[model samples]
Target: MGNLCAGASPATDETIASADPVERALAIAKRDLAKGAGKWQELYSYDRSKLLGSGAYAQVVKATRKGTQKSYATKIIKKGQYDKSVVIKEIAISNILSEHPNCTKLIEVYEDKANYYLVMELVSGGMMFDRIVKKGHYSEKEAAEAMAVLLSFVSFMHAKGIIDRDLKPDNILLSDDTDSAIIKIIDFGTGEFMKEGQTLSAGIGTAQYMAPEVFKGKYDQRADIWSLGVIMYILLVGFMPFGGKNDAAIEKAVLRGKYALEGEEWDEVSDEAKDMVRSMLQSDPDKRATLQQLQAHPWFAAAASASESAAKGTRMVSRLRGFLASTRLKRLAMLVVASNFKAEEVDQLRELFVTADTNKNNLVDFNELRTALSKLGRAVDETELRRLFDAADMDGSGELDYREFVAALVGQDVVERCTTARHGAFKDMDADGDGYLTPEEVLKMMPPGSTLEEAQEMVKAADKDGDGRLDLNELEILLKN
Candidate 1:
């Protein structure tokens, strides 16, 4: 009755300030269910699952929709840890900038007496720094491609008066663990909104990537250009451009802006690439390359042209189709890449769901799911296999139900809505939003002249499972028909 799908928990009557975090999350969920207003309706539709990460002031946890396998990351911050005004500004900035393809999306916001919950898109791909470490090296072309993508996002955000004070590689994420995965800039915790001429005074960014003007405690949007330059240098060559043994040394080196491009790594690298980095790393904020100039630079243009030409000549589409057809991981990646699809762009996804649900039990288990993939043709290591399996198994029951399967492929809110008890529309008379229609509520909803016996008979007729009370599902059956 609470949410007829299996493993669904009933909403709690307790206040949102409960001692247990899990209980608090549930209380908020129930609160939203009773109201069912705006984005919170779908956000509260999910059950708070595993803890993703924790910081000094907040913790991020995974939330999965009850009937579907859709996944999202919810950042739960205690109200006392941050200033209320700053939190509001951060949320506003996130909402405004999230629409860009390269920026991480913030889906919904919810709050309790003690905490604020921010639900955002979950990107499983590792950080750019970690990826660079794993790969060990990159070509200038690769570096240019990554910079172009990052700069485009920065340009978009700056145009909207949002400055990402932190632009380190740790904040840049790949969409997936693939050679051709798209880049996503994340973690706007230190982001601030400023006008074109406004300058920030706080020293809030990572030391190694901080611009010289930032150390002076006053700098404009050009400060971000310095960080981008450092990122490009690190990506192209395998080390930081600034030579330092510690933070103090790094700050000194950054202030000097005298890093060299003389090394075996730079032997084959073009001078244009180094020149682009120099333009960004200039000590004077006024002299730093603007986002427009950076994007229009020859290196960026070359990368864009090469990318276009390769796309036109490549059979990567057929290969991508095979990759998606071969594994659940690849299919999920496809869904994430195509996460912004319109309603009409996803008709074929339902068919993909049917294909993955091979057992025809309206559920998909790990073995059956792996069997759907071309095991021999596409090799999946143990780590990735477990990640794919566990993510789809929302209930931890070793199987993905129909809704879960669809949510895993697309997104949590992308699936069609599940039926709720329509008869519970008289929630005012019920006095509680526990998905039950009491005899009193039935009387109120019934005709004005209806008798108690008639109301009892009505409840009896609607009670399908015979629990003595009419649940949402039973009420829905009687009312919807």
Candidate 2:
């Protein structure tokens, strides 16, 4: 989310002078009740007094527990509203993620007379977008702290088979307590479930924070990584790294990969911090850093260390083991395995298997398989092809079964090699003790006589969406070309 929501209301309004921006915004939001912004009468049992906030597609209201005064945020979605599929998806995703600590907890859900109402915890703190604007970029330590909390939350969501397609500063909420502010990611209205080999074809999310591949209409959870990078950059810099005057210019600049970070503004920030942002903002999801990899980053090392240290005692260890054994952990492990495969490759393989297995015998002979691979420029000899068949034939049945073949190919290593190479490149790119690659480090990787402008040009070229950072794909592509 951008700062468009910021200062929309006057700061000195007496009604909200003592209240934070969130409270003020909630109050302003209640004004919509007079306009009858949504068809709330049918779905909700209460009247306008409980209304909270109203946005383009949904409205959040204060709903009291059936028998108690305890209040929760109830997000009401009319069935025939803005986008039905997206609304239902958001509801389902919120329900699925209700149990995770980092994610906003959903209290209860009910449908009445054609509308869906999702009850969730209401954090009193203002939006993260407000915090970034007010604070004007955080220090590396502050950024890392916020990121650690966000990463943990995102990791949990991914574990639950949910991809928060829209991850931005506004979607993230800061708790009222400033010292130990918990980052709760809300607004799952654009989220989607990712099954084995699932690839989202629709383009979604705020443009500036979106991944480059999203512009092409084919993306996965790695899209979240792109958004994460954007958020990280904003946390480090007061403005968006990919800002433009209009959507068209921004889109063109992004596709052409135009971006830069020079001058005194970026001097105080460490190279390692920049490098992490660069890697996360990679244009290609294939080359983006994994959540686990992000967690291991030095920027996050402190938090990681603290988390590890916190689990040292016997009671903590027992709890840790139990957590690892929980359904969430098991699902996360499965997601880690599934996330490795590229969406494009899986889609292609799906089509190939469907076409080649015309006999309906559920298996493809060696010749048929070889022919299919050949079309994709992956021709293999009889022995290698047989090995491929055997590897895919988990049942040990010599023949290459369709289901087994698809399953085998869906593994991370099989569908993509970008991640494998990115690890080596990241180490080489980070020449300094700092965890990131500076323009100087990036220049060092180039040929001799490459002017600063040339280096800057290359960086911009590789950025592939003007997001001021480079991912492994852009780096490799720029260097290779």
Candidate 3:
């Protein structure tokens, strides 16, 4: 038997080696670490400090990459204790929504003999509940705007066929410590993709946010809309729509849709907002407001217009840059933060990022950035400038890439120059005329300190097929994304 196994063909031997779970996992992790340039290396490169938190089956730790200085929340799960299928599914779902501004993106996944490590975006800011607590009381208009953003995100997910079975204030996180930071929906462990006419039968979700249909073991994506209603209610009035001394009681209240707006907090809230909540909290899933209907409602329309007006009024590049400098957010996280700013605000900052490109190399060095900021009247001291520039120069490139610059100053969602210069840039990275960019070629093209694994992950994300290489079509799709 041993001789037979050993004599297996190359492909068969590869398959047999991977049949042992530990060996399979170790191979994946080591292969990733060896690359030293991809997100996979993010796990090995980062120095883990204190434990961030623990869940029912996993624990998260705070980590900072050695060379890049980027921080990430690494969620470590014991491999033997959980369902591998569920973990894989959750990772896939997280990756699908990773680039969404309002989701806690899954940066990378790794495994060892005993544990599965999920490296994800670390939101330094606490939960939405914590924010509301810190403020003592929140304005109705602010709550309305937050809901608008949340609803927009959920709408985006539904359009992509994803359903966030879990939605609550605790799962909703503010992107940063700032009051105006974007709100992100986190913890997509219960999220699933559904096809047209499909209904989920799983009884999953927190009791308070659980739609009544969930108790009956039949539900659809609309269940998420109902949870949003509960969240909207709590956002306006600092309390849950359904509450009791025990889980059973809370579940009962949720099932019955037992909630009232009788409180000092609700005294000042508009009836229109309350009516909107009522529509969303409908006991019947069919009667509930879809994301489209919710957005088209007068409440969101008014609140959205108000938010746009507020954003327009504060569209000063100086103020925006000052905010960026103050936050001290990671360069990657800065991109998400930037996405929240108005286009005019981003356009003005683009001039700065461009002006900082003194050598016209499309990359900005520390001194060039400092000079540009000084010319713009936002001068920073040598120490602060060095710190800020270092943080933004991911990959230890010594200079900021265009995406990094936009992330630091412009905004997260701003298109990279690569979109317009696609072919030239793609060809430049291709190096050889091999029709495909190999790992070695990709590593050379990326910034310093970037891992070969990171480049591989980029290719994998855009590869579409299971092929290990990218073609021009794939490159365009990746650039657009």
Candidate 4:
């Protein structure tokens, strides 16, 4: 058998010459194994000289093991400073992933008098988020390869009944060299361990990437798949699929299950890649792609081959630079430029602009754009405003209409759903066979347990004309809310 231990250490240049490849490989791994303190006091037990960074509740310090002098990152979390349960959950998840090659290894975890310390592999390179921002967007091959690694780790976790609630670009850390990075799914404070036939009802995770089911308080491991979809979208398009004018708007959009992909922005991306993203981002959790399904995607297969070949090459810089300059990279760059914007607030502005434009024009006038931007905490000057319009107005029409606006704000599917829901809810609530719903009729449609006061409030809110009845426009607004 070929020597399995051939490339076990950074220092070693020779392949294992032993007759027993498996035994030799095991011995090689054991020899290179550098364990650190798995508990809290391991902080003082090592050199506390190198302080790397600090966060709201934890501080990461670069430390060396006493006996082996192996480098490690010691994350110290104060006992009362953060949620103890959350800290423990993160530790548990890290421990479970410790043995996976694609995962960040947790050396050890321990507790001292007032703090908990988690010793983990020290990834010298920074976060994938930082890399993407600096590099704009990655080549298809690079993005696919990185995604495959992450999917592998996530697949392993799912098989073990652990769901990584937090899946974002920031959580993925690179090694000393950028060529090989580990998808460190850190910050498992919101992670859930679900057994067969079990489900959870917790609305946790970042707002922009959260699924509709998450807001409805009905979620499971499939929630992770939704998050993966958002991540993949960002990886390809360099922006999120759902976001609205303000927090309320974003919440509404999410709750209503609005988001999609169509038009010129996605034209260059491969059909396989688009399919993979759509599969993951499905509004229904049951329809979202599972980890195994993702692994079998054509995109992953292509990426895996490229990654394996890249790993064997000696000139990493040249190889990566060539990949970055390829046609695929150029196409991805176009997508990135097409989707560039701040975040949720921009998403909201796009929504409002799309709504006000009404017609399918490519440019929104100053008045309409301002109205949208105002709802999202931004008031812009004419020049700055023009720049914003130019960024999203892909067709150069000098004014934006519904299709262009929706395309700029959220994906197409979301816009369709929002339109449908707004109309559907209004139709459903109009129960008296009249053209509209009166305050009394609206109250009657309320579920049995819904309080009388709550129903009255809904009527009051929906009665735009102050006549105790809701017209179609007023009813649509109420349903959106």
Best by TM-score: 3
Kindly give the stretch of ten consecutive residues in candidate 4 with the minimal lDDT sum. 311-320
Enumerate clash totals for all models, in the order shown.
1, 5, 10, 18
For model 4, residues 196-225, the per-residue Cα lDDT tens digits are 677777767778777778778877888888
**Residue range 20-96, candidate 2, lDDT tens digits:** 43344333333322223344343345556656678765688776665566667788765543443344345556666
* Ranking of all candidate structures by their TM-score, best first: 3, 1, 4, 2
At residue 7, candidate 1 shows an lDDT of 22
After superposition, the stretches of candidate 3 with alpha carbons farther than 4 Å from their true spots are 1-49, 304-481
User: Which model, 2 or 4, shows the larger lDDT?
Assistant: 2
List residue ranges in candidate 4 displaced over 4 A.
1-54, 66-69, 81-85, 180-182, 244-248, 263-265, 301-481
The digit string of per-residue lDDT tens for model 3 on 367-438 reads: 887676555444555875676677667567798776666555542223333233445455566678877766
Looking at model 1, the pairs that clash are: 69-404
lDDT of 3 at 309: 28
- Tell how far residue 224 is off in model 2, in angstroms: 0.7
TM for every model, in the order presented, reads: 0.54, 0.52, 0.55, 0.53
Q: Cα lDDT for residue 27, model 2?
A: 37
- Model 4, 406: alpha-carbon shift in Å? 36
Q: Would you list the C-alpha lDDT of every candidate in the order shown?
A: 0.64, 0.61, 0.67, 0.60
Better of 3 and 4 by lDDT: 3
